[model samples]
Target chain A: MSSSLAQQKADKVYRDFGLELEISNRTFFNDGIYSGQKNNYLSASIQPEYYLEWSGGEQSFKAVGFFRWDQHDNRRTHFDVRELYWQRVKGATEVSVGVKKVFWGKTESVHLVDIINQTDAVESFDGEQKLGEFMVHFSQFTKIGTFDVFVMPYFRKRVFPGREGRLRPGSEDGLVIDSRDFSFESNAEEWRPSLAFRWSHYVGVLDFGLSYFNGVGREPVINDLSTFNALYGTIQQAGLDAQLTTGAALWKVEAIYRQNEFQDILALAAGIEYTFGNVKNTGIDIGLLAEYLYDDRDNIALSGLQSDVFTGVRLAFNDTQDTQLLLGGIFDVERTTQLYFIEAERRIGSSFSGAVEARFFENVDPSEFTYVLRQDSFLQFSLTKYF
Target chain B: MKVLTITFVLLSAVVTFGAAQTPEEKGLNVAVKATKADEGFVSSVVDLKMILRNRQGQESERFLQNKTYELTEDGDKSMVVFNSPKDVKGTATLTYTHKIGSDDQWLYLPSIKRVKRISSSNKSGPFMGSEFAYEDLSSDEVEKYKYKYLQEISLNGDKVDIVEQYPVDPKSGYKKRIAHYNKDKGYRLEKVEFFDRKGEKLKTLTYSGYKQYLDKHWRADKFFMVNHQTGKETELFFNNYTFKTGLSEDDFNQNSLIRASR
Candidate 1:
């Protein structure tokens, strides 16, 4: 009876979706330009999801479709199927099939272990959105832990903005490259099947996850540094993510061991977030965050966070509208390169919100990848209204 | 927050009494009795619409879904997710209102894809830019405040017991709050008056549209809060309430807030 009642409460053939229209003005402060020029443009996207769910049926179906249009960047104007899946739960086992997004990680600074779906890079630089992948998945929840296995049949490549978008790697005395000028490692494309397994459970106050994946890498190996051409590589990775909540502090760690054609590397991010309830008797709150990121490959790593330390502060007003600020900086522990960033957000009302972000790079080394894009320091503001 | 939570040890500092039971004990007894009158609700889910009117009479509206789960020990857990005003849609807040010490609160921002813990110091701030304060969202528990019976009086043609309560936390925005309970109706809360730390009336909240659900439980379907200092008002209209939702504690945590809008 309770199961039927829960089904009744969630019964639906058509669920919910929304349209978001965003306009951004990007400026590059430098004597030279590499990929995208200083230009302002508007982008709009619509996501409508459908669910064929029965009040008493054991099987359920869902589909989500997303499409976007950009004013300047041709590659940004595209469409994707975020999710289209069917699932069923019987006793302790659950099964699902079709295209879907599976998230697998813990930690704030980066999502090191979440690699089921390829990132829709043009959507945002944050690597949060994922393009759905075709897969057959199964999971079993038991008293010991929950174990999941996946058989993925296809792959999706990472996309970059058109020649007009901002934040591209500098090449050959600041030559701009088009997003269309992209290639693969070889005859390899999407169609090969991949295998993955994950186990997660709560041990006392700690929630931990162990994942093993043997698939085509989501991130590309920079084959040609001058024009920044991406060559997707095959990789086998074992990842571990864990979090321990103790009082007002949370201990977070994300570690990944991976092997590709060029090298075998182990990377880790370990941090503790400790919060002090009220600051100076004011209702506003502040938190101190410190994390250390390390990679065995060190300086030659593409993204260049190797052997770095990041510390930041978070402020929360805790009002009904929810206002917050996060400011932090990452410094090379063994080098002179440092980067600082600020991210803030607040609600305008029930229907709208505003966000602001700023990033500045200082003392970048010539050998580091960040030196090329040193002029990309920028401030971004966006106002989004829901419909 | 743990610092202020540690200060909650002062709650045990209430002066003890001897022969003549003081007004403090009497007011607390009334509160405890009223709290016990409606128990074992387990869980509830409700939909609410909030209307805000400025002093100039311009108005705006917000829609949300609120879910509450009762805890036999510690505090009750509640989650609220915005459903309308397209910009703020899918935003959610999860609160654990402790029986003692400070409450634990977190807000989920979808744009940043992160969850932030709320500072306990600012519970008195306006809720959603509305007249209601953050503390107003709390589920009333006798332990959250220390009460003193003011008097028995007739308020707005109804006989009521006027009581004054002081927040246990020193960081509370209000110096004290006044609650008028309907004396003849099993001590039901009819109205509340909030005073700032400066001892000035800050806001007044009125409850009406009494509704009885599950036979024994009573809930106010309409709540109107007016900010005396700012000359603004917010009216909350509850659409429906469902009890015995069978919601578990796992549904009121950080993970739930991430998908609250979904």
Candidate 2:
């Protein structure tokens, strides 16, 4: 036996742990249209993770915890168990049980087929953050493809930003939705069981996933606009996400069809990203991205990305610090609404990294959902230290 | 006398032309011998420490673990999991190299628990901001390149044979590479010089501290690469290499990337 393996056998212990601390601040260019709204906000977050593996790497346990303290907006200051699961791998099949997060999507502009976990909207505006869902997961790998089955016993409600927050969903009268008054169409409410099945495979240059989900819908439906009453409807959704990689270009598409209480909704987000490596021999790579987003509900769509175009430019410095920048804009197809954003980040030192992000809302029409936040353009800065 | 001279000349010409091997055949023979000498290592796990230095001599370090699985039919499969530069900790990349086609690669971002299919055409781009490109780190299958034997010379007091290779991939950034193989060390690779697309010297890589494992295969524990055009350098230190670790194709797939531990 190798010395390292011999030493590992003697010790019989394998573990990994890390801690991260982040401090962030955001400043608005204009005051909020609502009353008693702050122009600036500061927040801090702490995240720690622990992992242990044994039995020849067949069985393992992992736990990741997150806590955030915001200077304003108590709804944004919360804690969550991002991942706490025990997994076992035996031959071609694997099983896991506990709270975990799963992400599924292929587009850059918007995510239409990603489900399973509730979005943590109060934490970030990008919709990438999610709360863990309790489930029993089974995965099998075969010659043709990989199959995954999930049985979630409980549902986690999607949270929204507070009234004083910048990006909350608002009405024409500047009234924010009160999630406290939310209702569920299912008799079991939050205790409703959710089931999902997905088959993913790669053939040649194309990688694709087809999935079906049944249970409570992730998006809240507004039954009464005046009272801002939100309802969670039990629905069924079928999703398809695929990407074709050809040379320096990647073509991606995500489509979803949902049968909800009010009606059936069809949505899609398709895009292409082409990268030019080592442009002009400067060791910098530049990528051009463009996408189209469509929703059948149009103006009444909850997410408000209906019939839009997204274009972006990504720059990778290819330096030791791993510096990167992305500039993007989303344009409404039939309206004057437009959103422009820029994000830049780089490593500070051995363990620290910093990022700057800014979003601009311009020429928003009253009919569009983003009109309420026309003056909510803001810039944010954040620094994180990892251990 | 004139007829005898003509016969002698004709005989010598036929003997030389029929018996001697061309430079291409000699190069292929060397490559085949080297490949044969290092076969039968089914799998391995190793730790790598990368040190990157700039023109100003500032240094940054990164640590990672690598697992490799060899396939008899196709090229090898490798998985790399980052352990340090903690912000990107637990991020992993999986690659399946093929002998004739473009390689398949996937990147797993631990923060989002997402696996993304990446374009392999970016093989010329620097890996982890190091001097080594993605193509440099991929499994070097003999079929990927066309080789020609150059000459034999003395390097570091040992006899060495120089071979020139031309990449078969159309998207390759390098025009050619000159590799030096140590003749006395089981035909192991010793040094390489890269030429850019414009046929200019781009970088030089030197391997040292070679140690034999399994009583047959030789592995270099250190590699230093210096970029001539950019005045940047990178050093890789390999440690704790163990062979036949029982890794399979399952350990080099997308699922493995997601579950890869630090």
The numbered model that scores best in lDDT is 2
Question: For all candidates listed, what's the TM-score of chain B alone?
Answer: 0.88, 0.91
lDDT, candidate 2, A48-103, per-residue tens: 99999887678889999999998887889889999999999876788999999898
lDDT by residue (tens digit), candidate 1, B1-262: 8877766655444434335558898889878878877777899999999998989998877789999999867778999998766666778998878887667776787644456554444666556657776679788888888999989998667789889999887767788999988776657889999998889998899999988787778789999999888788999999879899767665676555654545
Whole-model lDDT, model 1: 0.76
Give each model's whole-structure lDDT.
0.76, 0.88
By summed lDDT, the worst window of 10 consecutive residues in model 2 chain B runs over B253-262
i-RMSD values for every candidate model: 5.3, 1.7
Q: Assess the local accuracy of residue A129 in candidate 1 as a C-alpha lDDT between 0 and 100.
A: 81
Task: List, residue by residue over B94-172, the lDDT tens digit for candidate 2.
Answer: 8888989899889998888889999999888898899999899888888888889999999879899899999999778
CAPRI grade, predicted model 2: medium
Q: Give the TM-score of chain A, superposed on the true chain A, for all candidates in the order listed.
A: 0.88, 0.95
**Model 1 per-residue lDDT at B158:** 71
lDDT of 2 at B206: 95
